[model samples]
Every structure is written in structure tokens, then in C-alpha cells.
Target chain A: MARRNQHSKEELRAMAIEALADLVEREGVDNFSVRQIAGKLGYTPGMLYHLFVNLDDLILHLNAQTLDALNARIDQAAGHGDPMAVLKAMAFEYLRLAREHTALWQLVFSHRMANQAPVPDWYVDRTRHMFEQVEVQLKDWVPAADQRQRQVMARTLWGSVHGICLLHVENKLNVAGDVAPEAMLESLLDHYLSSCAREGEK
Target chain B: MARRNQHSKEELRAMAIEALADLVEREGVDNFSVRQIAGKLGYTPGMLYHLFVNLDDLILHLNAQTLDALNARIDQAAGHGDPMAVLKAMAFEYLRLAREHTALWQLVFSHRMANQAPVPDWYVDRTRHMFEQVEVQLKDWVPAADQRQRQVMARTLWGSVHGICLLHVENKLNVAGDVAPEAMLESLLDHYLSSCAREGEK
Candidate 1:
């Protein structure tokens, strides 16, 4: 019975986490308080404390959950077709995810270890594995003459995607004004594909 | 007399802006409120708002200032240096600034946009100019490559840099872990440089 009660409490805590995320997004994460989070859910601050230790604890969970979701999206994208196809799909899907879940995505990417220490290998492994997978697929796309150039190609292509996404996220681009992100990305794709052929020339 | 007062007000706002930037770096942007900003300097939120409409207005000012600073850095790096070298430096500097001014950097990159309309062309110009500069420099790096191929190479390289920076920002790895960001950046540079050479090989 105690175990059952504890499990139920954990589930409620998860729900609270979602609510907390919504609240944070609605109200800027800055100046957010435990009291406000509890108020939003009609609970007392002490009740909230029973589940998570503090704001940092809540944040850590949110960051970890976002990364897990991102990895899942990449994995799902990877499953659709050939490795090369999957690689392209993963890139698009990751960008889409970031666009759609802007708040959650930003939280994971921005509010991280301000004065904290180094990153762990497990986290490094998950991230590295995804990029390596992309590199592998890219190698298959490249001409047989330059398979050795996979890693950098992977990095460079990914950087362009990110640059565009960063622009979108920050509202830094007047996307509706002249050139749209889609058009920009389309050009990027065309350029990258042609560049692969150039690798064979020299 | 009115003009003199207007100029003094502008000067005070500018000073406050710089102070706010420094404070955001020291304290997570999420940690403070307008009241705190006022408290830091023995002023009032009313005084802060007199120069701007509200907290969000102040944020916009700070973000625009940060972007201008970033452009200067990019311009300096992009000038007279080898294109790839400049591209690499521009990227590293972007990440360096992100680390140094976590709050302001987040404002510039994250979707923290509020009460804001679509992004303007000035932002796009910065990005387009950067990309164009990169393409021009790459022409000298390779033996006459097609524009499309160069674009892809540029995109891929940019992605790699973003991925590394995003990784750092998201704290996907342990902030207290073993991998040094500088060493990781160096690895990325080496890999991309070699990859650019590979692009010419075919």
C-alpha cells in the first residue's frame, strides 16, 4: 500500500512538472517562484517540496527530459528509411522539434550550468553517437573517393541548420520579409549536394 | 535645455544597459526582476521604466546591443584573415560570447522573444553577410569549386559549430565532467579544415 501511494505521488509530481514548464514559459523563467508554481496548481509550496527538492531539481529534470525527447525524435526519424535518408530526416526533425518546443528547447540549451562544472561522458556519448550516426550516413552519400571527409562534412552541414534555427528561435530574421528559412535551407541543401561532387574533382 | 535633458537621459539609459548586461552574466537572467535591477543601483523600477516601457523593453535594448557587439566581433574576425580561418574564428567567438554573457547570449539566440514582431533584415543581413563572406573565402581554399557545393560545405561546417555550442549551452554533458570546451572546439576545427580539403580532392 505504501509503495502504491508513493508511485501515485510520483505520477502527480510528473504532472506538476508539465504544469511548471507551462507556467515558466507563460511567465518568463526569470522571477519564477516555487510559490507561483504551487499557486498555478492550487497546491501549497510545502506540498510541492515533498516531491522535488527545489527549483534547481525541477530544472534538472526538465533539461534531462528535453534531451531525452530530442534523442527519441532523432531515433524515430532514423527508423524511417535508409541511413542516409534517416540522417536528413533527423536533421529536419530536430529542427522542427526545436521550433515547436521553443521554450523547452531553450531551457535545455540556455539555462544550463552557468557556474557549474564539466559535462559527463554519458551525456557526451548520447550526443556524440547521434552525430556519428549522421556522419556515417553522410559518408554513404559522398563519392567513394572522399569517404575520409565524413566527420567535418557532418559538422559543417549541421552548423548551417543550427544557424538558421538559431535565427528563427531568436526572431532574429524577418522570415516573412524577403527570403524565407525554407528557401534558405533549400539552397543550403542544393549547395551541399553539389559540394559532394566537387570532392571528386581534386 | 530640453535637448540637454534628453541627452542626459539617453546617457543614463546607456549606462544602465551596460550594467544590466554585466549583472545578467553574473546572475542567471532568470534570477532577477526589474526590482532587483533597480536595487543594484539604488534606483527604482520607475526610473528604469522611464527610459523604457517595461522589463521586456529593456531586454530588447540589451539584445540589440549584444547583437551589435557580436557583429563587430564577426567583422573583426572576418576581415583580412583566411576565409576558413575567419569562419572558424567567428564561430568560436560566437560561442565564447555565449559563455561570457549567458543571459544576453540566451536573449540573442533563444526564443525569449516577447511583445516583439518578426525579426528584421538587419539580423538577416548579418547572417547573410557572414555566409557570403564564408563562400568567398572558400573559393581561395579550394581549386575553383561550384557555388552549390561550397554552400553545402558551409552549411555543414556551420552545423558542426552550432552543435558544439548548443551542446555546451544545453549542458547535455556534465558541466563538471572531463571534456574541455576549448579542446573540443579545436578538434572540430581540425576535423572541418581537413574535410574542406577533402571537398577539393574529388
Candidate 2:
């Protein structure tokens, strides 16, 4: 009676998000719009409204998935015996994931919300989870550091690697004869770990 | 007499760039267009085309100016007695500029050109000039390091600081009760300098 093929609201929602992800991967977040997504998914704008409260809500959901994929790759790089080695592997994995999903990974950082819009709790939790991965490995390397000190250390180290990947992904860092991203990550870790060693000795 | 109001092509070009800079500063690059610039400057888009080949060319010019402003800030933070001290000052200045001109600074890295379209030579020169400032200060400190080693070292150091500033600019690095950007930069510098000291000792 319902046109011989009826889909539940949840199924439609999943279909929309999947189609949106494909669109974002190909054209980037900046260029894509809700109207385009609706068109791509063969739904009217009014139908999309029935599915998502707003475009921002849709983007938030999309970003959550990107964070999960990053987290899984991060988990693979974990549990290595050496704390330094674990951190290094995590850095490599993070960069590799960024390269693999250039637009999606960039959306994690580049997408801006409206002014005074509180970042949703789910998004914050996802981000904090990623930071926790770094914090846990750092604890082994700097056992004496207090909680506050370790938090600062985790952000500092991850921020550095994030910067390296950002530059590499944006094609801004290859001016000097195409130095591989792996080399850059290794240089950063070598310098950072050597400093930690020196501190331990002191 | 052709016209009472006669401006040379170069003068009109400069005027368009200035108006564009103001437009980007106020409205952001995403919300601006050549038509808007023509509207602001009392000219037609066709007239504007005589000056800049395309919108991309106009953006490249604007980016060059931003890079110069950044290079000037880097220069001010240079020549300080302590290499570590100078590095810290440069980091602070870099963050300050980004905060002062958030959109403009972001455009420096966020603006992506089409594939197969090479970055203009002038833009490359401006970027290389900024890196060279870091290299000169590093050479005085790491006096015995050769050219290739110093190049890698300069990029590594700059990349770390750049990462901190980028995170701070994007509001992604502040999760734990507002750790100062200054504190993060210092932690990175202190650790990096200590590593260099250990390397020198070896």
C-alpha cells in the first residue's frame, strides 16, 4: 500500500548519512551543501528535513564517524611494548589515516560551527577519547609526571604531529624536495623522545 | 582627453588587492567574490579582470602580503641572544598574528588550488624566506650541523611550533581548563632545546 516498498525512518537516515559521506569524500566539506546531499540521495529538501533536524546536526553525525575511524587506527598502533614506539606508531597511523581520508579527516578540524554554538557532548567525548590514547602511552614514558603535567604533555605531542600532518595533507610541506611524511614524523619523535630521555637522566 | 579619472593598471591592481584584503578580513574568503570587490571599488568585474587573471591570482597576491606580515613578525623575534628565547618569542608572535588576523592567517594554508596548477613562484619565495629565518637562527645554535641536517632541523622545529599555533587558532587544543598557548609553546621549546643540547653533548 505504501508504494509497494516502504523503508523505515532509521533506514532512510542511514542511507542519507552514507550518501553524504560519499559526497564529502569526493567534493570536500566546503563545496558540498544540504541541498546537494538531498539531490544526491534522491530526496526533496523537505524529506531531508524530516530525516535531519538541520545541516549542522547531519555534519556532527558525519564527523562522529570520522572520529571513530581515526580511533580504530589509533588502537591498532597501541599496545606496543616500548612507550616511545607506541607513540611513534600512533603518529604514523594518524598521518596515514589523514592521507587515506583526506577530506573526511580534514573535516574533523576544518568544519566550523555557528558562533556561541557549544560543541555537542558526543563530539567532545570522541575527541577526548583520542587524547586519552596519547595520555596513556605518555604515562609510561614519564611516570613521575602529575595528571596536569601529563595532560599538557599529551596535547603538546599530539598537536605537533597534527601540525605535521596538516601541512603534508595541504601540500604546503613538500617544497623542499618532497621529504616523506614518515621522515618528518620520525624526526619529531626522535627529538621529542631524546628530550624525554635527557629529562629522565636529570 | 580619455578621462579625468585615470588610474594605471598597476594602481588599479593595488586598489583591488587592498579592497580584497579588507573584504576577506571582514567577511572571510568563502563569502567574497570578484563581483563584490568590483561593487566595493566602483568598477565592473570585467574591468577587474584586466588586473588579475582570475580569482585565484587575486588570492595569491593577498596570501603573499599575509606571508610578508608573518615574516616581519618572525624577524622581530629574531637576533635575541638566547636561541631558545628567540624561538619562544617567534612562536608567541606567530600565534598573536594568527589571532589578530584569523581568517587571513588561515587562508595562508587552508586555500587549496586546483590539481596540476602549480603554486606561484612568488608564493614559494615568500614561504622559503620565512623558513630561512628559522634556519639562520638555528645555524648559530647548531653551528657544526651541515646544510642538509640544518634544513631538516629547521623544518622540524618550525613544524612543531606551527602545529601548536594552528591548533590554538582552530580552538582544538584547549580542552583542560584553558592551558595558555604560551605554556604549550614553552614546553615544546624546552623539550626540543634540551634534545638539541643532548645531541650536542654527544
Candidate 3:
């Protein structure tokens, strides 16, 4: 077993989160356990509990890290560009993130705590922040849209994009053909946004 | 314990499936097991294998049953009416089904076999039939639209509706308030279909 005393609290936390993520990636959330993660990190279960309130807290922290990484990717994809182009870029980046991190993405959407525990505010904030990035670009595209309209539009579009990604990631969209998810996202964005275009905007 | 020898083979199969569904409902798919199912039905593991090719096959059959139930609800909702009215009705019924059968709905969208087994064709056919219901209505609403447009439109709208339902089901959409999922569905349908309305039609 590795010595926990050799690492600082911050270092131990980071290592535990990475080990948890790796476990989720290999065995999926369904098969995940705190003991397995503690074992993997060469720490006692007591050491893990000392670091985290519980397994759910640890999972939430891992999810928060995922949201942070996704937020960064979206920020990168939104590098100064025409509003619509940046929007497209962001959606593409979101798809890539979901594809590259299928298990984590699935956990974000599908995993619920043991007893319907409320998701922490910080976790919710991270989710809202990701959409706020989309809403920011949306304002540039449709300056006249109101706050509620922007909110709904942001949720609608993100949810739609998420569904597309979910279908692709879960292997529901195309199995035998090896179709690129980017092509599918391109068509969906074209169809959806064209429909959003005002009468003369097209 | 259920008596395995007392029931006919068909009765045993039905009992096993019912027990499986109950297990999924109580514990979620993450905790599902064929042994639990066999135990519930007082059947040997060997007997379950005889009834099903494996657990995956049994789960597929359960998913198939869910699709059938959903299809029936959609058909009932589609009772001859104005095309838009029927579409709205269908969407509401879908939300109801998902809310009422959250575990089954999650399994339908999220679960996959461990070995990447090909989804049986009949399963694919059931899914297509659900979309075909929407396609049939779209034909009535947009007769001028061609086949490819109908296919894309069907998938896009369904994905959007699903995204909306997913957010609500997963408790991400309206955590702090009692915002009705029906209200969200209505706004999405209005925005999506109004955008679909042809110039003359609108």
C-alpha cells in the first residue's frame, strides 16, 4: 500500500479523483465503489472518508471537474469569431468532449445519488455556466431576444445538442456504417438554426 | 418463493420478466442481476439461460415491452385530430410515460449490453415505428416536404423532445421550483413547430 502521509491533502484529493475517474471509465458508474477507488490509490477507506464526506461527495467533485474541463473546451471553441460560427464551434467541441469522455458524460446525465440527495449548488452552477457561454453567443446572434427567450433557447439548443451527442455516444445513431458524429451534428445544426433564422435573415 | 415446476414454461418466462422489471424499478438497472431474477422466480440459473439467451436478451425484451407500451400511449394520444393537436397530444403522452416509468425509460435510452452485441432488428423496427408516428403527422402538415427532409425533421424534433424530457426526468430542469414539465414541453413544441410552419401556413 502507498503511504498517504507522503502526500498533502490537495495531492491526495487530486490522486483520488483521478483514480475515481479512471475507475468510472473502465468499469462504468454502475460498477464503481469507494473501496475500489481507495484500493486503487493505496489508501484506506478511512483515509478516503477523511478526504471526502462520502462516495457521493467524491463523485460530485469528479463531476465538477468534468464540467470545468468542458467549460474550458467551450471557451476555447468560442475564440473570437462570428456569432453563428462560434456557436457551431462550441457545439462541435461539446460533441467531441462527450465522445472522448463517454463514461463521464453518461455519469453526468444518468447517475443519481443513493437517496435523491440535492445536487450541490456549485455543481449546478457549473452546468449553468456552460450554457451561459452559449447564451452569450446567442445574444450576439439575436440581439433583440429577451432574457426568458435567451434562457429557453439556451436550454433548448443545449438539450438538443446533448440528445444528439447522447445518441451518438450510446451508439444509438449509427452502428455498422461508422458515420462521423460531426457530420450528423453539422446537419442537425443546419436544420435547427435555419429554422431559427428570421424571415429575411436567411 | 415462486414454484418453478408448478407453472408452465410460458408462465415461468412471464413471471421472470415481471420480477426483472420489478427489480429494475426498485434498484435501478445499475443493481440488476439475473441471479436476483432467478431467485425471485425460484428458478435455477440454468433455467433462466434456457428462457433467455442471456440477461442482455431479457433486458432487450423488457425494453421492447416499454416501446410497445409507449407506442400504444402515443396512438391513443393521436386520436384523429388536427395535425398539430395530435402532435401536442403525442408529446404530452410521452412525458407522462417517461414520468410514470422513469426506470424503464432510462433503460431504454441509456443501457447497452456489456459485449457490444448488435441490437436485434425487431428492436430497431420498434424504435423506427415510434418515429414513423411523427413522420406520418409531418406528412400531413408539410406535404411539400420530401423524404429526406421528413427523416431529418423527425429525428431532430424527437431528439429535442427527448432532451427536454431528459432534463425534467433527471431533475436538472426545474429543481428549485414546481415548473411543470408539461409547460416546458408546450413551449418547446410551440417554438419548434411554429418554426416549422411554412410561410403561407403560418
Candidate 4:
């Protein structure tokens, strides 16, 4: 109770998100409760509501943090290189993040808004930005592709990458056989990118 | 209570599973309770327990049914035709099922076992069978690839397709821009399969 006066609203919000991330990483988002977060911070759920509109609001912020982290990783992987190599590296980085931070990554895709409201504009921009990373490389790799074509290409490629990671993380890929996700990803890049390269040559 | 003796154990099990599937298709698997299924079927949770080991068991049964429906649709699409056309049709059928039966298709991928037990042998077989449908077409399209290569190829191609649909179903794909999922799938297959065709030619 005395701790309520110790921090500003923003500070409490950050602390709550940090605690929430740790809990999600440990126990997963399923059956997760706002009280658990407040309990970890020695605060009350009512106090958390003051900082965030509700649990969904807090989760959305956490997901936005995750998107930012993912974007930073993609940026690191997208450093000056051949466009094809950069795209492949970016995807591998995406897969690595999903593998290493299973719960957090799953939360981004799995958590639907409780009220079924549209996602916020900032969040949509963050997500679209991920595709933009691929679009930038595709521009270099296939100069003839216009903005619309690049948008389609980016979604196709990244969506495929995401699908592989999703199935892998959910433990569904092995049902297809014991092929590693890396192998599948490599094969995809080999066939799909080579085809794109040929398309560029034309 | 009077209805208790009306059906044999097997009949009750079947009826309960049918009712559970309807509920899942209507309401999704999240926060789903066995009590709800029993309530729908005019039985008690104790009776559901007799038919199912637990709620996970019931959900697994429902997922298995979903897989069977998907398999049947693919089979219908896979009828005698050019392997490429058949493959494309099968993929489209998959997309159609996901779009039309959104909740049921989602449950097949989204529901995780509460106990974290390895998925049952039959469920694995059904999931693997979905990939095999692709493998059959790949066999015709790329005859030179060995068993292992085809297995990898199937996972890669289908994984990408799954990724596109996943993002589409979860409403994440449009953030990448409004490229139709069908268009993306077509591009993936055109690029990927053409590359495989060239590989076979080589």
C-alpha cells in the first residue's frame, strides 16, 4: 500500500510489463491473470488498472515491446549484405527469437483482443514494419518489382517464414517428419529465392 | 437422468464428441470447459469423464475430426489431374476450409495439450497425412528427389502455405498490406514449384 506513492504511473506501468513478461515466459499466457502481475510487483490489480486500461491493454503493450525487440533483431541481421543473404539471415533470426523466447513470441500471435477491437495503429505499423524489412531487400534483389508487387512478395516470403516458426514452436512440424525447421527454411529459400532471382533476370 | 440408460457407452461417446465439435466450431477452444459439453448433451461432467480422459481428450477428438474433414476436402481436390493443378487446388481447398470453418480449423493448430504430453499417435498420423498429400504431388513434379528430399520439400512448401494462412486467419497478414492470401499462395507455388521443376530437369 505504501509502495503506491513510490513511483509515477509510467514507472509502475513499465515495472508491471517487465513482471508480466517474466511470468509469461515462465508459465505462458494461458490462464494468466492480472493479479499475478500485481502480486509479483507487490501492488494490487486496482493499481494496475490505473496504469493500463485492462489486462488486454497491458498485454498489447507487452506485445508491442516484443515487436520492437523482433524488429531490432531483424535490423541487426539485415546489415549490409547481398539482398538474398540478408533476407535469409533475417528469417533465421526471426526463427531463433521464436525458439528462444517461445512464450513471448507465441503471445504476440496468440493473444486476441478480448473485446475483438481492431489492433491499434502503432501496433499495426510495427507489424507492417517487419514486412518492410523484407521489402527493402526485395527492392534490391528484384528492382523491377513495383511497390504493390513487393508488398505481395514480402508477405508471401515472411508469411512462409512465420508459418514454419509457428508450426515449429507449436511442436507441429515434426508430425510431417523429423526434418529440422532450419532445413525446411533453407530449402524454401533455395527454391523460392532462386525462382525470384530468375524472375529478376527476365 | 432418464436418458442415462438410453445409449450404450460407445453411442454416448460418439454423441458427446459430435456435440463437442459443434461447440468448438461455435465458441472456439479457449476457456472451454467439459462441463459445457455435458450441459449441451444433457449429461454430467462425470459422464463426459467416462467418455474422455479429460477436456484435452475431448478437444483432441474434435481436432482429429477437423483433420479428417480437411483430409476429405483435399482428397476431393486431389482427384486425377495435373499434379501442379491438383496441388494448387488442394492448397486452395485448405484455405477455403480455414476461412469458412475458422474456429474449427484454428483449434487444430491452436489448442495445446494441458499436460504437455506428446500428441497421440493417431493425431500425428493425421497431421503427417496432410503433408503426404503434398508429397504425392511433389513426387510427380520432382521425380529425382529422394525420400528425404521430398519430405523436406513438403514441409518447406506447406509450412510456407501454413504461415500465410495463419497470418491471414489471425488478421496479421493484412498489416503487411492487403495482398490476397490466395495471390500470395499462388506466387509461392509458382516460384517454388517452378524451381523444383527445373531441379528435376537438371
Candidate 5:
């Protein structure tokens, strides 16, 4: 009880989320429980409830953290270069993180809320930020594209990249051939971007 | 027991898979059990064991059935036409099936076999056959592409399409904007095929 008082509610919330991430990374998101996180933090489930409405709320917070980490990685990879080169770098970086943190990445996309609850606005903003990274680069690479076109192109390209990675992570890419996900991503970008460039010329 | 003896093993296997599909459709793949399936078939779990080695084997059969249904749908959609049109029609047919049969489609991709057992050769062939649909059209669309280029191109294109659909079905496409999956698929193919044609010209 004394230990609990030593930390503010915000600090306890952060601690619980960190513990949740570690637990999920080790055990995966399936059938995960708040009790396990509370155990890790040396708090009772009741105490943890003070920080989160429920397990869903806690998982959402953890997913938000994963999104933050992904954004940071993309930002780091967005070095000065040709827009095409930067986009590819960021994509490969995204793939690397997904591969390295498979559990966390899967949770971000796979953790459906109870009863199909609407994702909070902040969480949607995080996802939008990911697409915006691609949008910014597309703007540079295909300056003529209107906002609608840019939005579709960014989603199409990244969605494809994501599909490849999702299949790769899930061991479902075997049907695609022996070609690595990296090669497929490169080929996809090469052809799609070239097409965009040609369209721009026309 | 008398009822079980009346049906051949093959008949029983088919019945079990049908029941499994329905159960999964109604409930979902999560925490699915062999007992529910046996109950559906008026057989005991031990009897189900006679038909399938275990739950994993049963689910694989269900997935195989799903793939066969998908291939059939693609065949129905692959009416003779310009290769581009055929591909687009086939892709849309796929998107339609995915949306309508969301649960079955999800089970096919989401079910990971226990112990990481290798997916059987027959299963791999079914997946290959799915890609072959795209390859046939690509050959007509890009006559210059060799077997390897065709393979890469087919996978890259379909993988992107699959990624887009996966996101849409999972309700994760909200970040992409309000563009329907159908429209996005059309835009992706238009850009990618145009790019390939230009490359062939070069």
C-alpha cells in the first residue's frame, strides 16, 4: 500500500502499460488477462483497474505505444534523399520492426475490441499518422497527384506492403513463391512508382 | 454408433468439415473445439478422431474446402475478355467473397497449425493454383515477362490486392479514406498494369 502511494496515478498507468507490453511480447495477445499484468506490477487486479477501465482499455494503451514506436522508427528512417528512396527505407524499416516485434505488431492490428467498439479518436489518429508518412513522400514523388489520388495511392501501396508483411509474419507467404518479402516489396514499389512517374509525365 | 457405421469414412469426413465450417461461421475460429463439431454431426469426439487426426487436421480440411470454393468463384468470374478486364473481374469477385464470407476467409488465413507443422503439399498446391489464375492473365497482359518475372509480378500484384482486402475486412482500412475496396482495387490494377505495359514497351 505504501509503495502504491509513492507513485502518482499517471506513473502507475505507465508502469502497467510497460508491464502489459512485456507480458504480451512474451505470451502473445491471445487470452491475455489483466490479472497477469497486475501480477507483474505487484498490484492487485482492483488496483490495476484504477488505471484502466478493463483489459480492452489496457490493450488499447499498449497498442498506442506500439504505434508510437512504429512512428519513431519511420521518422528515424526518413533521412534526406529522393522521395522514392526514403519511402523504401521507411517501408523496409517498418518490415524490420514488424519482424522483430511480431507480437506487438500483430496486437496493434489484430486486437479487436469487444463488440466492435469504435476505436478511440486518438488511436485512429495514430494509424492516420502512419499513412501520412507515406502521403508526405508521395507528395514529393508525384507532386501532381491531387489529395484524393495521393490518399488512395498511399493506402494502396502501403496496404500492399502490409499485406506482404502480414503474410510473411503469419508464415502464409509460402504461396507467393520462394521470393523474400523484401524482394516482393521492392518489386511492388518499383513497378507502382514507375507507373505513377509515367502517369505524371503523361 | 449405428449411424456412424452407415456412412463411409469419406462421407463422415466431409460431413465433419461441413459442420466445422458452419460452426466457425456462427461462432468464429477462436477457442473452437472438436467437441462442438462432433455434436453437430451427432458423433462423439472419439468418432471425430477416427475421421481426423485432431482439430488441426479438421480445420485444414475446412480451409481446403474454402480454397476450392474461392477457386471456383474465380473461375466463374474469369469470363473471356481482355486479360486486364479478366484480372479485374477476378479480383473483384475475390473481394466480394471475402466480404460476404468474412469468417471463412479469415479462418483460411488466420488458422495456424499446431507445432508449426508444414502445410501439406496438397494445400500448397491449392494456394499455387490461386496464384496461377493471376499468372494466366498476366501472360496475356505482359507477353514479354518470363516465368520468373511473371511469378514475381503475379505475387506482387495479388499480394497488394490481398493486403487491401484484408485491411478492409478487418475494418482497418478506415485510415486509408472512404474509397471502397472495389475502387481501390481498380486504381491499383490500373496503375500497376499500365506500368507493366510501359515497361514492356521499353
Candidate 6:
């Protein structure tokens, strides 16, 4: 009897999904094909059909994976440090991912993340958990900020950091020099923080 | 016999571009066809061909109009107010435009704007002129702020505003109901300006 492959169902599923990510970047999402994916990996289209009904199903899976990767990065970075320092670090980490994974970031982010098919409940838990960490860290920084202001401030920072990252990925900023973006972001954050310090002195 | 249309050339061009914008929303930039534009209005594709060489020419024309519209909105909102107020108003106007015209905003924004064929020098003039107006206005607010701090401050404000606008358009904010975005933005502006005033005091 021929030796049987050792991979279990779950292992095979993981492998297929990993392959899908590489395929998305190589071939833009709009043109991706289930047949093409299976063909490149020496699996028949019939096997892919068994796993995913169509490109939408594959897209939903990829979207969830991207969010999980983002949540993991933030979680890992937040592990040890002053919460304020870690919050700033998380901003850098988030921007770095957006820069490196522009195509994938654009794909999932261009469509609202929550609008996609629901991922496992843990996914929402992870996202909300990360935001809560950010919120608490921010309160430590701006103790006088009211609950509403705190929420809005957090949202503003979220937008500001993401904006710079979006510009970096899209080459939107018109600056002449090749300045390190993260360094520029650090400077911006420092100045913003200083303004707050000066405010509290009054 | 060809009958003369009542609308002036400028009016016709403007109307046609409005129709073009509608087509773009229905079909994204890549899928858009000049033939479809003419067909929708019962005109032959030849009419569109006569106005522009290809899709690039047409898109460039449409995008230039968008930049012009931006300048008009900024002029209407900010004029030569307090430097900080000018930036604040522009931020508000930018958000308004982005929220109102989601697809068109993405098109006219930095990345897509740069990729299109080089517009006339005046077109560049309009964009730069607006930035220059802000740079000049920013002077009064940052009288005490160092040059580098001022640069970073302006950049941060602009980036944050852009980022927030995009997040809103993407429906990622989950802003509370019954609160106009303007109200929230205006309140945030007050908070930011008050903080800046404290910075100026020191």
C-alpha cells in the first residue's frame, strides 16, 4: 500500500489559506481565480471547490486572517512597556504593517472590516480588547480628558496615525526627502503630547 | 444637418463631466468606457472621442474639475481667517467633501491625482496656492512654536483631518447616532484649539 500523507484536515485548511495570501498579492484580488490557485499548487480545481464555494468565500477568509495578523501584532507589541510608550509603539507597528502589506491592507480596509462576513467571536474580542487597551493607556496620558473627549481623542489618534501610513503606502505625502516615516510620526506624536502637557500646566 | 445646441461650450463640458462622474461611480475607473458615457446620453462615442484622445484625457479633465471644486470650497470656508482657524475650517470642509463624494474623493486625493497625466501649470498653481495660503496663515498661530514643531504641527493636523475623513467615509468610526459629524468635529476643534492656546501661552 502507498504511504498516506500525514496532514490532518485542519493542517490542510491552514496550508490552503496561506497559499491564498501569496496568490492575492501576485494576482490582484479582482482577477483571482479558484482554478488558478489550485493549478499553481498542483491541486485540482475540484479540491478547491470542496473547500470554498467561490472567490467571495476565499476573500472572507483572507480578510479575517489579515485582521488576526494585525490584532496579533498589536498584542505582541503591547506585552511589555509603559502603556503610553506601547501605545506609540503600536502606532508604528500598525503603520509598518500597512506599508509592507499595502495591497492586502487596501483590499480589506477599502471595504469596511466589520461589513465583511463575521469571523469567529474571538476576532471581535481581540479587536475590542486592543482598543480598550489603547483607551486606558490614553486616559493615563490625559487624565483630565472627559469620557467623551477621551473617546474622541482616541479616534483622532487612530485617524492621524493611519493617515500617515496611508500616505506612505500611497506615496501621497509630497515631501522631497526620503525621511523615515516612523521617525516623523514620533516627532509628530511628541509635539502633540507636549501641547497637552502645556495645557495641563494651566 | 447638425443643429446648434443651446448650452455654451463651457456649460456642455461641465454637464458632460457631471455625467462622466455618474458613470465612474456606477463603474469604477478601470471598467469605465467612453462609449458608455456617450451611449447613455444618446450621443455617439465619436462625440466623446472628439473631446479627448482616450480615457486618460477624459479622467484628467474630470479630476482637474475636482481640484477646482476643492479650491472653491476652501475659499468659501477659510479665506484669510486666523491661521489656526483657517486650518480648522479647511479640515472641516475637506471632511465634508470626502463624506459627500466618497468615490470622487478617492479619485481626486493625492495618489490618484498624481497618477493622472500632468495637469496644466495653473492646475498645480491652484493646489499649491491653497497650501501656501495655509502655510502663511499657520504663521500667526505658531509664533511661539519652533519652525520644526510648526511644520510637524501643520502636517499632523492635515494628516489627522485627512485620516478622519477617510475613516468616516469607510464607515469605520461607528460614530454615535443623532450626533452630526460636524458637531463632533467642531467640538474636537475647540478642544484642540484650546490646547494650542495653552501652548501659545507658554
Task: Give the winner by TM-score.
Answer: 4
Determine which window of 10 residues in candidate 2 chain B has minimal summed lDDT.
B1-10
User: DockQ for each candidate?
Assistant: 0.18, 0.60, 0.35, 0.80, 0.59, 0.33
What are the runs in model 5 whose C-alpha is more than 4 Å off?
Answer: A1-9, A27-39, A42-50, B1-5, B28-35, B43-47
Q: Look at candidate 4 and give me any clashing residue pairs.
A: A163-B163
**Worst ten in a row by lDDT for model 3 chain B:** B174-183
- DockQ value of candidate 6: 0.33
Assess each prediction's global lDDT (C-alpha) against the native.
Answer: 0.63, 0.81, 0.77, 0.87, 0.84, 0.64
Give residue B4's error in model 1 in angstroms: 16
DockQ of 1: 0.18
Query: Could you tell which candidate, 4 or 5, scores higher by DockQ?
Result: 4
The pairs that clash in candidate 6 are none
lDDT-wise, the better of 1 and 5 is 5
Model 4: how far residue A42 lies from native, Å: 1.3
Better of 3 and 6 by DockQ: 3
Number of clashes in every candidate structure? 31, 0, 0, 1, 0, 0
* lDDT of each residue in A110-185, candidate 4, tens digit only: 8888777778898899988889889999999889878898888889999999999888898887664588999888
lDDT tens readout by residue for model 2, B103-154: 8998887787744479988889888876788778778777777877777777
Candidate fnat values, all: 0.10, 0.55, 0.24, 0.98, 0.69, 0.31
Interface RMSD of 4: 1.3
User: Over the stretch A1-202, how does candidate 6's per-residue lDDT look in tens digits?
Assistant: 2224476666656767777778868764444577777766567777765676655566666777887788788878878777557877888888877877876776666543323454445444544555555667777777777767666666666666777777667654554233356765775566555555455457
**iRMS for model 1?**
6.6
The 10-residue segment with the lowest total lDDT in model 5 chain A: A170-179
Give the number of colliding residue pairs in candidate 2: 0
Q: State in Å the error of residue B153, model 5.
A: 1.4
In candidate 5, residue B132 scores what lDDT?
Answer: 89
Higher-ranked by TM-score: 1 or 5: 5
What are the clashing pairs of model 3? none
Q: Tens-digit lDDT track for model 6 on B111-157?
A: 24323455556555655555555555556775777665555555555
Pairs of residues clashing in candidate 2: none
